[model samples]
Target: MEKPQRGIQSIEVGGRLLTTLAEVGEPMTLKDLAQQSDMPAAKAHPYLVSFGKLGLVEQDAASSRYELGPLALQLGLACLRRLNPVRLGTHAATALAEELHQTVALAVWGNAGPTIVHIEESSHPIHINMRTGTVMSLFKTATGRVFAAYLPDKVIEHYIDTASHHSFAYPKSDLRPSWKAMQKTLKEIRAHGMAQVVSEPLPGINALSAPVFDHEGHLALVITVLGPTALFDPALDGDNAGALRACCAELSHRLGYAPE
Candidate 1:
């Protein structure tokens, strides 16, 4: 006997239509959807009708524009729940820490800044006052810089504006660099796809961090490794740096980020 077919032909075609709409990230009319899906509007109408009945597509009665339905949002939320960056980074961070014998941390862009969400510590303990939920500065730490390098300009602008008013232990003069210098640093970080800081955020500590991007090429999470400055060397080609980049690239791949 032959193996069972995986999916109905009509369903596969309908899925292509749905994906085309999703890729555009906007509601589209029948003509636009048909053209984008490379099908005739007459052919596409039937698929849309089925999708509408199933609550996978919704049409605006006024304009006849079609958008993803509530069910699509429900499905997207479910997918996001499964794609939690902290959960995805757990295994990778643990393996890196064990292999390199350094503290590995996972951070995500939080309301305040790059917020630590998970950590894997090596056998050798390092003294630093940080834990899950700790938010680091946008310019002072490797994890924070990786976020600064990748996050949108508006978000970084907000951070800078907020940081100026709130006083921190670090002298304001030191924390805020000339805009020119800051841009240059961020440019270099973008070029390298990673960031490193040595004994700046905290004395005697050194860190290197690489970004993990989502399918949209947005910063999803950052993986960082830290150790005593004396023991940790933040070399781009060094063992720790190479491992961190590889681990982050793997995570990004899982998130569907394909580099151009």
Candidate 2:
């Protein structure tokens, strides 16, 4: 009554076909894969078809190509929900927004970059409208830059390369030579555990962002408060710098970070 002993080896050619095709970042024509993998078109056909059906890969009609599929998203989201970093963030964001009379956003690094999937907007009309689910680049934004600044150089470099090719409506000066400002920004972020952008990326908008380090001490998310310049008090250190640092520390603590 033993099982058939299922494994990737059960597939044609022992899953070598699947491994090779899955590694291709962009879609590739079946013909191209057959040629590259040294497998005949007839032999490769079933693997692509079976893998695509399982959602491990996808096929494009116009080009007759295959690439990774949404199943990865399905799995990743399941993991994130179990981790529930957002739940920890939710309570903190609400409390802080109420206390400060400003907006609170919980952003996570994602495909489009730091997306604000949760937001509590200010009641006043003269407030910044950073709505939920708003996505941005990893460089030219407070939420985005804060995450990029805190992440390791490997992560930063990958995002920078991706961001450079990404399409966005901003001045070239804002993004020229991507790493130029990263080191300086990272120093500020590491020292204060947060980063600030004033009247930047847009007029009249100011933001303070802090890293939400996970239990493993890696940045898992970022909490950012943004508003019009008039709403922010330009003084915390007995000076503006001190006050901003305090804000960063406060947000970091709300995420369970005990500063040393």
Residue pairs with colliding backbones in model 1 are: none
What is the TM-score of each predicted model, taking all chains together? 0.67, 0.57
Q: Evaluate model 2: give its TM-score.
A: 0.57
Clashes of 1: 0
Q: Write one digit per residue (lDDT tens) for candidate 1, span 115-142.
A: 8999898888797888998878777788
Model 2 scores a C-alpha lDDT of 0.67
- Residue-level lDDT of model 2, residues 1-260, one tens digit each, is 98787666456472665556645546788888777777898888887788778887788888778776788547645755566677767876777777677677888877766788788776643444457777755666778778877777787667655565666423445454458657787677667666677787778877777777753467778887777887664232323344435544564554444444
Model 2 off-target regions past 4 Å?
1-83, 125-129, 166-174, 234-260
Highest TM-score model number: 1
Sliding window of 10 residues with minimal summed lDDT for model 1: 166-175
lDDT score for residue 40 of model 1: 95
Residues forming the 10-long window of minimal summed lDDT in candidate 2 = 234-243
In candidate 2 the C-alpha lDDT for residue 112 amounts to: 60
Q: What does the lDDT come to for candidate 1?
A: 0.85
